[model samples]
Structure formats: structure tokens, C-alpha cells
Target: MKFEIGEIVRFRKKHPCGDDRWEILRTGMDFKVKCLGCERVIMLSRPKFEKSVKEKVEVKE
Candidate 1:
């Protein structure tokens, strides 16, 4: 699973704000993600984040 900063990803579960989409802010041993719905930021361990990811939302280059 390759993730880059500024990429949008869909999670297996919905966020508290009811959105399942998140934007990747930082990626490494841990990932910094922002909630698209509430603009909230959260950090999760790489392994945990990977397991929660359902799909990577394609970004138009």
C-alpha cells in the first residue's frame, strides 16, 4: 500500500463527522490524516492505518 501526502483515502469506517474520506498529511511509521468532513487531524500508526484503509481515492494530476 503506497500512500503519499495530499492523497485522499477512504477508510473502512466512517468518521465521527460521518465521512469516510481522509486526506493524507504525513506518512511514515505513523500517518497524519485530516478528516475531509470536519477538517480534524489525527495520527495513527502505519499498520493500523493500513488496515483501516478501504481504498485510495484517485487524485487528478
Candidate 2:
């Protein structure tokens, strides 16, 4: 799966805020993601990020 900036992805695990959705901020060796629920930002390694992704969401806009 190709991950791009501004893309929304669902994770296998739910965040503390109860949302499993995350927005891709920066993608490279590491991925920067913002939680859709709490709007909190975090970084994950490429492998880990890919492994945790449940599905890729098509952004309406």
C-alpha cells in the first residue's frame, strides 16, 4: 500500500480517545500521523505503521 500525505487510515488498534482513524502527516522512513479522535500527532516506523494499518480510507475531499 502506498501511503501519502493527507491520507486517512484506520488502525487495527483503537486510540485512547476511542478512534482508530489516523491522518498521515509526513511519510518517509517514519510516518507522522494525527489521531482523528483527539487530533494528537505521533510518529511510527514504516514497518510498524504498515503492520498496524487496518485499512486505507478514501478522503472525500
Candidate 3:
């Protein structure tokens, strides 16, 4: 559940744009994520985001 800025992650669900990859833009009570394929930004609650994220592409640093 711990991730850093500039990290990439894949979500458990596919976006409407048909992509699963996302980059972490910011993290806090809410997370800011951008779709890797379409570069769309979305803000989600921490728990919701944690559930949506399938894997982290970059290790926490």
C-alpha cells in the first residue's frame, strides 16, 4: 500500500480507455493517478485506490 511519487502501477481493473497501467502523480488521503496509455488523471480515496491497484511497477523508495 506504500508507493512513492513518479512510480508506475497497474490496476486490477481496466480503464474505459482499455488500459490498466497508471502513474502515481501524488499520494495522501487521496491518490492522483494518470493512465499510462491515455494520460488521464483521476483522484481516488486511499483505500479505494489500494484496492484498485494490482501491482507497483517501481519499488518504494
Candidate 4:
């Protein structure tokens, strides 16, 4: 699973806002993700993100 910055992914779990969509802000050991539904930002580790992500919608160049 290859991920890049600015990509959108749908996580297996829904956020409190009831949305599973997230936009990738940063990638590496840690990732900066912004929730599409609530416009909230969260920092998550790579392993955690990988485990949470159910599908990658878009890949940034």
C-alpha cells in the first residue's frame, strides 16, 4: 500500500462526525490527517493509519 501526501482515504472506523473520509496532509512515521466531514485534523502513526484505512480513494503525485 503506497500512500502520498494529499491523498484521500476512507478508514474502517467512522469518526464522531459519522464520516470515514480523511485527507492525508503528511506521510512518514507519523501522518497528519484531516477529516472531511468535520474538518478536524489528527496526527496518527503510520502503522495505525495503515490499519485504520479501508480504502485509498486518491493518490497524490
lDDT of 2 by residue, 1-61 (tens): 8888998999999999999999999999999999999999999999999999999886635
Query: What local distance difference test score does each model get?
Result: 0.94, 0.94, 0.90, 0.94
Q: Candidate 3 — worst ten consecutive residues by lDDT sum?
A: 52-61
| Residue lDDT tens for model 1, 1-61 | 7888999999999998999999999999999999999999999999999999999886626
What is the lDDT, from 0 to 100, of the residue 59 in candidate 4? Answer: 71
The full ranking of all candidates by TM-score, starting with the best, is 1, 2, 4, 3
Candidate 1 residue pairs that clash: none
Winner of 3 and 4 under lDDT: 4
Runs in model 1 deviating more than 4 A are none
**TM-score list, all predictions:** 0.93, 0.93, 0.90, 0.93
How many clashing pairs in candidate 1?
A: 0
Q: Which stretches of candidate 4 lie over 4 Å from their true place?
A: none
Tell me which residue pairs clash in candidate 3: none
